[model samples]
Target: MAKLTTRGLRIDSGGTGGGPVTIAAEDVAGALGMGRLKPQAVLVGRATFCDDNRAQLELAKWVQQELHRRCRRNGWKTDYCEGLAQLCVFELVHPLRCVHCLGRGQLWLQVPERRGERIVLVERWRTCPRCKGSGRKRLTVRDRAAVAQIGKSQFADVWAERADAMLSDLYGLQDDVLRHLWKQFADEAA
Candidate 1:
């Protein structure tokens, strides 16, 4: 079971010592209240610490149903709908770190600066070009196509759009869970 507190959100991790895991309120507030999507809050959104994983399961089921409906409407075979939905949910829940920036979403570049007739290199951070500051790697076309059981051309032409929609819905589900956690924290504080 998980408990929301003014200090933090506590979950029984069932570790070797049987101690509960506590996530700071500040972290929760930053991730949920400010929509920063910090790692701890993301884990919470995955329902990892909860006794029942109904929220995530329900959202995944919704994604699968929506994808099936869209595939039928588009006259595409729905045989791979479950796999496609699973892929989308996995992307939403466990996004890979951007390799380019090493998940920092920024790069430290040495810039030449002139100070008192001397040239010195100063380190400055810039947003990562590869991930566009998102810090997450995108699913490749080949992988997505394989998951959808479609050719790359067809996936690129039409299936990708449907996949993106399902991904968006998964994001919405995460946001909704975060919002609910935020409300619970607020209520606890009151």
Candidate 2:
């Protein structure tokens, strides 16, 4: 098992073999050949990267569980569940979202008629500043509200329902295929 701590979070990343086992640092890319490594290491807000071995992942799980238990014992009602959902979904599925245009792909380059100078064929499209070229504004068209509900957990049921369809179509993976792979894969690095 591998163990590490960063920003006060502990990670225990080893486990039974054939499943995901958090390997040493140099082992992660090599481990890619063995199998996919799920990002089992949970993290706090905006935290990225973690120890990916059995010991480190285990400790991470333990810390989070303890925090939740303590919160529950004292009736703090921490929103860990929602946070976790957001973390997992964003971590797992963000790349898929990147493929989408987010309603903004390009804009026509401003062309000027100088009447004599050779007509410079400007590049056809320029990136949108609003969406940062991701084409998706943080605001929804209907609600005109910021896109705080993007991650997951906070998603409305209707959105989730639509998202399932989108996921099925966009990923080109059937629900069963994802479940099968997810059940088997434990070493997704990216």
Candidate 3:
């Protein structure tokens, strides 16, 4: 008797005087339903952004458009205004919890045991290794582009603050664009 095994399927007999049998790649893939292996990607702000924040980002986009319109109307010269708006919006949104741990800061492990002819599964929770029990992680990035863009926004804010103060001291009022922009930011913060 000859035995052949593929993915735990055992063949105990070969009717022909066969040394080996070859299987086509397509046949195996079709049998395993490999065509359905890939999933459609979901569009979102950050790779690590949670579903709960999706609606918040949408609302922030509306605010960003409003700010952009106001800035344009005021003839303000701001580089990366669109990117800054998005980064500011994301910053305002609450920090996302660790996707690996699902905000639980812990992981549930399944242990299987054989009991007679049946398998019993048990689950236990332990601190998540990825989050280190903090339950949060910074957003995932494809590269340093996101970090650089965020840095630009921080510098813009600082420069705007100084320019606002200087303009106010010289003219008895702050720059209208900066005042309006910060007001919108404060509203979003609240």
Highest-scoring model, lDDT? 1
Cα lDDT tens digits, model 2, 60-115, are 35444554665577675455533333323333233222224444445667755454
The per-model lDDT (C-alpha) reads: 0.66, 0.36, 0.41
Order of models, best TM-score first: 1, 3, 2
Candidate 1 runs further than 4 Å off: 1-44, 47-57, 71-80, 110-122, 179-190
- What ranking of all candidate models by lDDT puts the best one first? 1, 3, 2
Give me the runs in candidate 3 sitting further than 4 Å from their true place.
Answer: 1-51, 95-154, 157-190
Give the per-residue lDDT of model 1 (tens digit) for 1-190. Answer: 3445666676443232344555675555344444445443454364432322664566567678878898889898887787777678667666788999987778999989999989999999988999997687987989878766678898888778878887776666555554555444444544
The global Cα lDDT (0 to 1) of model 3 is 0.41
Regions of candidate 2 where Cα sits further than 4 Å from its true position: 1-77, 80-84, 87-104, 111-123, 139-190
Local error of candidate 1 at 132, Å?
Answer: 1.1
Q: Which of the numbered candidates is closest to the native, going by highest TM-score? A: 1
Clashes of each: 0, 27, 0
Residue lDDT tens for model 3, 1-190: 1111343222212333223332332332232222222111111212112233554455445545645665677676555455545543453334467889986777998878788999999887878899887575655442113632545455455433433332223222112212222333334444
- Poorest 10 consecutive residues by lDDT, candidate 1: 11-20
Candidate 3's TM-score reads 0.27
